[model samples]
Target chain A: MSDYSSEDSETEFVLYRNNPEWKDVTPVKQDDGEEPVVAIDYTEAFWQYRREILKGLNKDLNIELDFIHKVILRQSKNYQVWHHRRVLVEWLKDPSKEKYLTELVLAKDAKNYHAWQHRQWVIKTFNLFEGELEYIDSLLLDDVRNNSAWNQRYFVINNTTGFTEEVLNREIDYTLFNTKDVTENESAWNYLRGLLLHDKGGLSKNKKVTEFCENLYKSGNHSPFLLAVLVDMCCEQINEGGGDSVYNLDRARTLCNELITKYDTIRAKYWQYMLDGIEKRPKRARVKRLLRAQIKHMDS
Target chain B: MFTSETMPSLKFVPELHKKYLLFILNGKLPNLESMETNRTVLMYFALAGLDILDEIENIPPERKESIIKWIYSLQVVNEEENISGFLGSTNLITKENRGKNSPYKWAHIANTYSCLLSLLILGDDLSRVNRKAIITSLKTLQLPIGSFKGAKEGVEDDMRFVFCAACICYILDDWSGMDVELMVQFIMKCISYDGGVGQGPELESHSGSTFCAMASLALSDNLHRLTKAQFTGLRRWLLCRFDAGFSGRPNKPIDTCYSFWTGGALKILNAYQFIEDPNNDQFVLMTQDKYGGFSKWVNTVPDPMHTYFGLAGLSLMNISGLNKMFCELNTTRRVHDCLKKIQEKWK
Candidate 1:
């Protein structure tokens, strides 16, 4: 992607993420006892391989070609990765056979999550599988938090095949989310009944989404985009009411409790979304904390 | 921690800063100190520079709220004559008796585009904008030659009007506003002997005109009429303009705004990738000033148009750590997002 030499330290960081010594610099790490990231060698090979692929000499660089044999695939946790692998299948020499084989091999290993989602994407993209619903009970055990797969489950149930109301209800509870519109409280109330019916579902569905948003705050996704997304879902759970708006506001207050401890300008956009999610009427103390946090953030 | 060095390539930050500030503070272009009421090609660079700097805070809150009021004043919808939108550049001869900010006549295509952009940049939701007035105004601009004249009177009818119309039509999110087939046909006729698009048929192919033509087409989303062969030729003509920066025509000295003009054309054509050269950073940097503003070239005085585009050129190269600024102006995503939101809300 650039002209910098393989030895250039700046260029080295692109591939040096997983190396033990460079751990502080990169968020990437390897599984224990694996080869420490060999950046210079990898970058050299990548450049040479890219040169061959770019100038009409060769097309396939085969970064992941014929490499993984582990049915237990955990390459990336994101749904985007699952989507890309499906796209990558088309660029392969024999797409249908090759991707199908890859899918089967992956699923056979420890019931892979994204690989399962890839199978769903392939099934959905090409319209191949007709009887996929027969296996939803078994597949839901792979990862309960695989919201994408569960999201797809609703799509499959609604679009692909008819599921009994009982099954849909069971699946929603077990899947950690129920497809109730947070926009209207009635939908949230119904969903609460459904979520309580399955697993250790102690809280109502509204409480669960709120708790889920709080748990996400435990991570560093306090950016405005994240809070905006969270509040939107909460608002959607109870559409356009001052009450739901107030409820979301309370949740936002809980989310930003650590403002004096940590918060800055770069993170201010996310804070704005958090405030907006409360329908722009935040707690006075929280407002004070936010102002102090923003001032300190901008000052530094 | 985040600095200009973290961008795709370094241009003159000082030059860029100076040019951008000039763009904001009413640039000193020879005798032209500032535009009073009407918007021009200059405002695109000016507003775009503000976007690049992430400094919407500099814009007064009421600028858009009032500008909307001002644009409304220029609209002559369903009048005695089919007088479309006209730009009121002079405050001297108008109905309103103000020495300041009165778009005192019918609106023009370019002003319509500028006013809308100014609104968007000011972060105003465009709910109050009169799309119909602008669209109805656009309908009256078409001449017999299939090209558009700027206004009903003696204004020049050429590629600039076409670009402005395209931008206006685009900003309104309505292609029904313009005669798309005729516009495409007219643009097709403007293809010069060199396969480059021009202002009108037989005019010399220029970077500014080429951008106007290409952007109009891209905005219209009538790109299928523009064949791949033409795109390839355009791609070639555009890439050849580069000597650190791009020129408007072949063998012409590259100017600063062509970074946007030619670069913007290349961007619309999806051919920006072929021109990304890491070695050319120094050439781009030459346009930069250590204090502020970018010049057209290395040794010139800095201004806003170049400043806006120099940053845009670097953005096309996907410089790391500049993602926030880059994503905001992401042409495809921004348009597509707007379109999707409208569809969902209206659906």
Candidate 2:
């Protein structure tokens, strides 16, 4: 951010002053040029570089061996850098090779959204299949609350190809025991619920999530943000395609009341009305009407 | 890869305006606690970006009308008061005490350029903007040596404002903001041994300021306006920027915003057509969160300003599912439509 202000100090040599002068870049390393070469024009060298870039990107191999990383690092904002990288990645489509490369990329920038996105791209496009709970466990060991890792965990268990009830059950056990705080517990709940929603292998899993949520409600720091997530998740279960009308409704209404008494925020209030809106009960209807009136005359 | 379906939430919003204005109400105009202090300034893009996307919902229509009306009120009407239609950076009208909080009572070329762009983006009729005042302001800002100052006041003159003045005059169908001959000479001077133009002649070429210099010429109806050597050099400099997102200069990390800043420059140079499309979309869209909003660099916080530019970069490719927003002006393709309208109405 401070670099934005560094504009004033460098008054001399204008733009890119004191930066490295570009050399006459050849398309290749010149496989056998042993003799001393003459100085070449930068513009011509630039053309050669672009020609090479296009060539590298246009390779027919299933997986390109082009060094797109080196190219993207040069001019960071151009469309060509992104275009070339994608082309090169598409060129490198061997599933076994791509899976190995994904691990290398994750190691290089553990939080690189682009690299991670590219790995997902490789998997989705190439049909690479693997179990990830063991890998996810290692990430949690480093930082249980790592948001991207949590997101990746969710992506894998829910979106990926290989998963079983046993593996996911293993996940619930690890997440329940290893997580240090309540946020992690809530996060684990969210991830596990995603699996249950997808029904990977159709083993009843939300029972584990249901048990965890029950425990968390009894004793855990409930931030409104998290509480909001809790209400939504509950609403999902209640609103399931063919849920138990009696059980889910009673639980939703009772929990909504519990949430309203515990959290006095607007979102909580709205969710309370929504849960109550499940049925046109006299008290709930009256409150909903009053809230709407207040909202209508909001400024007042 | 291009669809908005991957997003956890997909909804059109013109919500940031109220949030930003409320910050001013709270005496947090800079809103250091919030990331987008530049909103009041960049609303030109935000409002316009939304307009281009055709997603100006969440803002009540009547209130949106009033905000556009107020933004129009800030335009420098003419040269009589030594004012112009170039928009002032932040015009805070608090508690009936109007103009008390305006940082400086002058038109900033950059803000003015952006303000008109926002107006155009929000589908404002351009009749309210007084072209002469903005042109006068531009004329007043340009120094004798070919550089332009930010405002009419004794201010630091540089290439950024030169771009702003050029944009205002271009949109307004006027060129009073610049002495084109001297402007060209200054740009020529800024050209280093490499083709890229810097803040000034003898300055190093930077992707950011270089956009200003190049786009200034392009909008001025002077794409072939530079010396032959300068033109070729500009081409060379732009070609060097084929990195992941387009860095401002060498050894800088690629960020999403530059995709438009430099990508637009190449488009203006007629060089953008040379680059392929899918890579650009995948790159810029990578900045977008699966949940919401776009970030600057990868794995960074998402905010309004970069979101605007990130979308603009995609729009440059005419990517589906987004309004086509010009990277520099940040208005819809309707600016060219407006230009055609002006030509039709006047011709």
Candidate 3:
């Protein structure tokens, strides 16, 4: 039998630790006394250092990926681990498989922030905008309440089509359709509001959106989101000096009162604040208000 | 199961929370293994929680000195490479290579932020901090877009790092660390379609990132960067998140942490008055664990992060027995006053 020295046996079990350069390196201990608040496990410290050494050595990408996969599986929300994965994917220059990994992580926890972030990075970095809308659609179809999917839909459109006039019209219709399905869904309402604001003219300029809100309001839909959108529309008109300023201010105040009394009582103070702003019109708008008051006085 | 009617009488147990934080600081707690890399952050939650609870005196003077020394030990300064920041722990440093710089030993922006705050909470003068080296490192970490990376060559550059960098610059009273104009531009780009800010451009609007962005701007005194319409939209987005307590995103379940993330944002925006206080306070109190800590949700295990944020959320509402927190700096008014005095001295 070949003679095996103890040193060789030690080297076989311990990889980076037994290296000549690392021989003098002893992991620094935290000065926390016994039973420290944040205990530093020296074993973990050693392994962390060892991994850094291996990373410096230009280890195989597959090995690093596998290690990262295991760590992410254990701790999906760890930002550091996700950052490490991004660095590895950048090094590999092949983010083709990253989406699938993010999908796996998201499957375990649908709202995993780190996973969604990684997915966004992969899609953006590789310019993989194709079929992403369909992916978002599938996610929304499964759970229309998934705000992440709604946000992703907005992201994909902004990145791919640049949200041009045509795209804005299409998105407005799309969001309206979803809002019709779930009148109480804040995500859909927020999406519609976002689309309207992104248009060249602000919310008041979007006749289609105003008509949609008017239709919903006339249909006896008192959803707080719907009412809030109407108030926003009125405010936009008043702010832009479009249509009848006095009428829009009155309408906005009424809508705010409705929100405070019945629709969104939880945020009554916000509605009251809106009412105060409407009542305290800016100097330019106040001048318009005084003229209207004089006209009303003359008519009376 | 806790509804308005069924909720227990609201209680602010400062002593219980103080005991819990002290125990965690002096003793070990299980299930925190995942935070091994974020030791400094963990310490911040504990120390800062105690500060908010007005029980910093519980920690003996000798112990405070050791803790300060421990925090200082994690500082990594290499003036030649213009790198200076604090490590989360001494894990990467070794006995023989403790003071010498290595490629693997670099400062993490988040850790550095936590370290400065921790030192302040412990009443350290911050004179031992390497301001020049840290400021230089901060300059290098800034991306062209005005956002910052957590460290050099760090991949996770977003509003979170921007907030950390802002806090560092504000604490050190140094504006040369980052380009404020570029940082403002980056924050503007992060405004999502829904008016809430996201971690980065074109990303989903999240309450946490909204707080980070808003606080960064507030600290830099650049809140004027937001347009009037944008400010209105932001306030609308934040107010709409109230569902008993605030949620990070639309159509999401309410978590205890958003009380700080969302509430703190509103506080900075001067919109805190819009929140329904009783409902929010009840929801937060319902998540308070009887054993002495707060969790993200009801019936979940309590952790240091949520515990600190929970106390912070209460402090924002001026809950009795808790010190008033400076929402922007994530510290008590007393500690922030101390910090302000230090900055005055620097001037």
lDDT of 3 by residue, A126-224 (tens): 998888888887887788878888888888887888789999988888888777868999888888877876788877668787777788888998999
DockQ class, candidate 2:
incorrect
Which lDDT tens digits does candidate 2 get at residues A1-300?
001112233554322323455244323231111211111111111222443566777744432333444433333333334444555555454445545554566565555444455555566667653655467667667756444466556556545533476766776666556542645243444444434544542323266655565566667645443454455444544444323443355655665666566743323434555565554444554677789899989877
Q: lDDT score, residue B93, model 3?
A: 62
Question: Worst lDDT window (10 residues) for model 1 chain A?
Answer: A32-41
Which number leads on TM-score? 3
True contacts kept of 1: 0.00
Writing each residue's lDDT as its tens digit, candidate 1 over B55-164 gives 54655656544444544443444344555453433222233333223222456666666656655655555666656666876888887677887665435577878877
Q: Give the runs in model 3 whose Cα sits over 4 Å from its true position.
A: A1-37, A45-58, A242-247, A286-300, B1-3
- Per-candidate Cα lDDT values, in order, are 0.51, 0.54, 0.82
Write the residue-wise lDDT of candidate 3 on B85-115 in tens digits.
Answer: 9987766666667678987677889999999
TM-score of each: 0.46, 0.47, 0.90
Docking class of 1: incorrect
Best by lDDT: 3
Interface RMSD of candidate number 2: 27.9
Please estimate how well model 2 matches the true structure, expressed as its whole-model Cα lDDT.
0.54
